[model samples]
Target: MTSTDAASPLDFPPTPAVILAGGLARRIGGGDKPMREIGGQTILNRVIARLAPQCCGLILNANGNPARFAAFGLPVVADSVADFPGPLAGILAALDWAAEQRSGIQWIVSTPGDCPFLPRDLVARLHNAQGEQDAELAVAVSDERAHPVIGLWNVRLRDELRQALISEGVRKVDRWTARYRLAAVSWPTAPFDPFFNINTTDDLAEAERLVALDATAA
Candidate 1:
C-alpha cells in the first residue's frame, strides 16, 4: 500500500467503484458470501466501508434477487450477459451501469465483495499507476500475483467489452485485459495481502483471525 505521506499526484478524477458480489460461492455453500460475517460485521459492510471513501461513489454488481442487498442502500446491478460467465460479465455490467446511472464517470474500479482488506489508496494508486505507465487499464498486484478481477476500467470500452463477451464469447478477464495496454501496481504483503478474498469456510475463518489481528494492532 502507498503510504499517505508518500502518495503520488493523481491526474485522473475520482473513479466510481463497483463491488462484484455476483458469485455462486459454491465452496461456502450457495449463498451471498459477502453477507457472511467477519468480526461481527458483514463482509459486504467491511468492503463498502473500505471502498466508499476511495471512490467517487459505489454500486454493487450482484445477480439474483437484489432485495437481499437492499439494507446496504447501494444500487445493485445484475449481469448484462444472459448466463453467468465470470467476473468479466460482472465488470461489463458495472461499466454499463456506471455509464447510465453515473454522469461524467468515464472510469471505474472493480473489487471483489469478499475482499474486506482492500488498501486505502487503491483507487488513487491505480489511476496513478495507469498514468505513470501510460496504460489504458490497471490491476492490483500483491506478492507478485495479479488480481485481474480487481481493476480500473475505462467505461468507454463498454461496447467493445459487450462485443467481446456476447459475440466473441470472451469470458476470461486476463484474456480481455491482454488486448489493451495494462498496468500492474504492486503492494506490500508483509502484513497481509489487501486483496485477500474468502472463497470457503476455512478462508472465512482465516479472515476472522485477520480481522482480530487488525483490531488488536489498532
Candidate 2:
C-alpha cells in the first residue's frame, strides 16, 4: 500500500530487529558506517534510538570482533555463511539467533546499519501491511523504490535462506524475496527520507544537515 493509505489502530506484537553492519564500506573507507558521527551522535546510536522502542529486542549483525560493539550492549552475531555472502547472510544469522534465543518470536525486522533516520513505525507498518495483504514478506518503500534490506522477515524461512546462500548462492535480498508473496509498504519522503542512508563522506555531511534541520523543527 502507498503512504497515503489511511492509518490503522491495529497493534502488533513487538518483533525482534537486527541491524546489518557487515558491509565492506569501500566507498566511505573500510570501517563501520554506523560509527560515523552526525550531530555529535554516532549514526548507530541514532539507529538504535529509533528502533529499540519499536522492537522486542535488538541485535547487531557484524563480522569480526564483537567486542567493538560491547558498549552498545547488543548481542553481536556473525554471519554463519562463509565469505560474507551479503546482507542475506546477516538476515540468516538474525533469523537463527531469534529462533534460538527468542523461541516465541515468529518474525524479525532487518535494517541496514547506515540508515540513521529509520521510521519509528517501521515494524508496526510492515506487520500491518503483511497481515492485510496476506503476504509472506513485507518490505519498506520510499520515493517509489523498494528497500529490500529494510523489511520484515519470517523466522521460519531461515533454513531456506541458508540453503539459498550456501547451496544456491543467492546473495541479493530481492531475489529471494521474489519467491514470496511480498507486500511493499510505502513511507513519505517529503520532510526527509526516513530511509536515508550514509554511503559516502558527502552523505555524512548531508546527515549532519538533516540532524540540524530536525533539531530546528523540534
Candidate 3:
C-alpha cells in the first residue's frame, strides 16, 4: 500500500486523479462520451489505464445517472453546488473527497474523461514543474497552450475554491487557475496530444483513426 505522507517539492505523495465525467456532451448527442467505445474498450477505461499508474487513487466526478457509470467502480462523486457549475465544480467536489479521504493528499490531477491520449508521466511532470515554487496549481500545456482542466491542484487552495463556489460564480477554469501560482507541462505534438479530447462525433472519428494508426504503427 502507498503510505500517506506529507509531500515536499522533493517528495510528493500519491495524490488522486479526478476525472470530470459529468459534461452534457451536447455535441455528441448528450450521453457519456467517455463511456463511448474506442479500440474495443470504453474511453473511460483507457483514461483510467493511463492515469492509474501515475496517481495514488482515482475518482469519477459525474452528477447524473449513478447506475449508468457504476461499472467504473470508482467512488462516483457529484458537484457540491448546484446546476452543474462546470469543471471547476467537479474539481471542488474531488477536493472535498480528498480532504475527507486522508489528511495527507497533497494534490489532484484533473482530467476530462474524453481525452484518451493523456500523458503517461502526468503526475511526475506536474510535481516537477511545481518544484519548490509557491504554486497552488499546475496544469498541463502543449504547443504553447494550457489545458486548464487537466490541472495539478494543491490541497492548500481548498478554502479559496470553496469560497469561490459558494460566494462567487467561478465557472471558468482559467479564471480560478489565475489566482494560483501555476505552471504548465508541455508535450510535443506529433502522434499524441496528451490532451486530445473527443467533444463531437467527428472528434471521436478522429480518435478512431488515431487508434487505427497506432495499431498499424505497433
Candidate 4:
C-alpha cells in the first residue's frame, strides 16, 4: 500500500458524497445492508457518522419508497435508469442530483453504504492523490486491490458515465474508469481493512466482532 502524510490543501473544499445503497442484497437475504445493525448502531448510521465530517453534504442513493430512509433526513435519490443496474447507476444518480442540487460543486465522493469503517481521510487522500498525479479521477486501493466504488468522481464526467451505462450497457466500474487518467490511492490494511464491507450473514457476524474489537481497543 502506498503511504503518504500529505494532506489536502487547506483551501480545498469538501466534496459532496453519495452513500450507495441501491443493491438488492440477495447474498445477505435481500434487504438494505446498510440498515443491518452493528454494535447497536445501523451500518448506514456508522457510514454517515464517518463521512459527514469529511464531506460537504451527504446523499443516499436508493430505490423503493424513500420514506423508509426518511428517518435519516437525507435526500434519497433513486436510480434514473429503469432497472437497478449496479453501483454505476447509483453513482450516476448522485452525479445528476449533485449537479441539480449543489451549485458550483465540481466533484463528488462515493462509498458503499455497507462499509462501516470507511477511513476518515478517504476524501482527503483521494483528492490529494488525484491532484498530485494530475489524474482525472482517483480510486481507493488496499493491499494492492482497488475498490472501484470507493473513490472520487468528477461531476463533469456524468454525461460520459450516463452514455456508457445507458447507451453502451457498460456495468463494470473499472472498465469505464480505465478510460480516464485514473489515480489509485492506497490505504494500509494492517489492523483491519478500513473498507471492509458486509455482504453475507457471515460477513455481518464478522463485522460485529470487529466492532467489539474496536470498542475494546478504544
Candidate 5:
C-alpha cells in the first residue's frame, strides 16, 4: 500500500459502476449527451462496453425520463437531490442505489456518460491507487488535469454526501472530494485520453473520426 504500482484487478472488491447521464447538457443543446452517436453506436453503448467488464454491476444515473435509456438495458437511477444539483447529486444517487439494490457492494465507480473512451482498467487503477494512498476515494487524472466525476467512491460516504448536497449546498465535485483523503491516478494522454468527453457537436464529430480509425485498425 506504500507504492502507487498497479495492483491485480482481483485484489479489488466487487465494485459497481454508475454512468452519470443526468447533466443539463447546455453545451450540446440540452439532451442526453450519452445518446449522441460515435461511429454508428451511441456514446452510452461504448461507455457500457468499456466499464461493464470491470464492474460487478452497472447502472445509469440519469434524470428525467428513464424510458429513453431502456434500450441500453441498465437500471436507470435518477438523482436523489432535486433541481439538478450537478454530478455530485448523481454520484450520491448511484451510491444510494448500490447500497439498497446491490448487497455486498462497498465501492461504486462513477463516470460521465459523455465519456465514451473511459479506460479499460479504470476500476482497477482507481482501486489500486486508493489502496496505495490508503484513501477513501480515488479519481482519474490525465494530462495533469483531474476528472473528479470519474472516480471510485466509498458507498459508506453516501449519507455525508447527501447532507453536503442538501444542507451544505455543495455542488462542485472537487469541493466535496476535498473533505476526504483522495488518490489521483494519472493516465497517459498519448493515443488519446481515455476520459475524453463529448460536450459539443464538434467533439462528437471528432469522436466519430477516432472510432472510425479504431474500427479500421480492428
Candidate 6:
C-alpha cells in the first residue's frame, strides 16, 4: 500500500458505518458527549440523522452503557481486543461486525461522535476512491489535513489489525492507515469541513452559534 493512493466512490455496500464513540469525554464534565445538546437537539440525534442517510447501516462502537443506545436501531459493538484500544479497535470491531452481517461487506465508514457537521457525502466519496482496489482504505481529506479515522476501511485487514492491537501495540491513527493502500478524497473546506469535532464547552457553544446562523440563513 503506497502513501498516495486511496479508495473512492467506485465501491458498493453492504458497507456499514461505525461511529467511534469509545472515547471518555473528560472535557465535557464526564457525561456522554454525543448526548450533549445543541440548538434544541442532542448531538447524538443529529449525528445519527446525518450518518443514517449516508451509509447502509450504523453502529456505535462503545463499551459501557450500550443499552442507552438501543433506541438508535443499530447494533452497538464493543472493542473485542482490549483496553481502550482507540479508533483502530473500533474500525476492526466494525469490520468483524460487518463480516458477520453478510458475505460481501468490503468497506466501512467511520466518524467521531462529537463531530456534528459530519460529511453528508462521506460514504459515496470514500467508496468512489476505492475503485476496485484491494487492501485500500479511503479517508476524507480537507484543507490539506487527513482525517484518518474518519475513513472507509476495507474489512480484509481485520485480522492484521487485531494482531496489531494485541501484539504490536499500535495506537496511532496514521500508523494503522499507513498499513494500507491509503487514498484521500478531497472535500471543499469553506462552507463545510466534515472533520469538525467538539471537544470543549467553548466549541459546543460555537457550534450552537453556527447552528443558529445556519437557521437564519436558511
lDDT of each: 0.88, 0.89, 0.81, 0.89, 0.87, 0.78
Each prediction's TM-score versus the true structure? 0.94, 0.94, 0.91, 0.94, 0.93, 0.88
lDDT digits (tens) for residues 114-143 of candidate 4: 999887778888887888899999999999
Model 1's C-alpha root-mean-square deviation from the true structure amounts to: 2.1
Clashing pairs in 2: none
Model 2, 1: alpha-carbon shift in Å? Answer: 14
Q: After superposition, how far is residue 78 of candidate 3 from its true place, in Å?
A: 0.4
**Candidate 3 lDDT, 1-218, residue by residue in tens:** 02112223334567789999989999889988788998788899989987887777899999876788878788989998899889989999898889988578878889999988776667777787787565667888888998999988887788789898779988889988897788876767666665789988888888988887655532
User: How many angstroms is residue 157 displaced in model 3 relative to the true structure, after the best TM-score fit?
Assistant: 1.2
Error of 6 at 135 (Å): 6.5
How far is each candidate from the true structure, as Cα RMSD in Å? 2.1, 2.6, 4.6, 2.4, 2.9, 4.6
The better-scoring model by TM-score among 1 and 3 is 1
Give the C-alpha miss distance for residue 175 in model 4, angstroms: 0.5
Enumerate residue pairs that collide in model 3.
none
Q: Which sections of candidate 6 miss by over 4 Å?
A: 1-11, 132-135, 213-218
Report the lDDT tens digits of candidate 1 across residue range 100-199.
9888888999999999988777888888888889899999999999999999999999999999999999988999999999999888875777789999
CA displacement after TM-score superposition, residue 184 of candidate 6 (Å): 0.7
**lDDT agreement of model 3 with the native:** 0.81
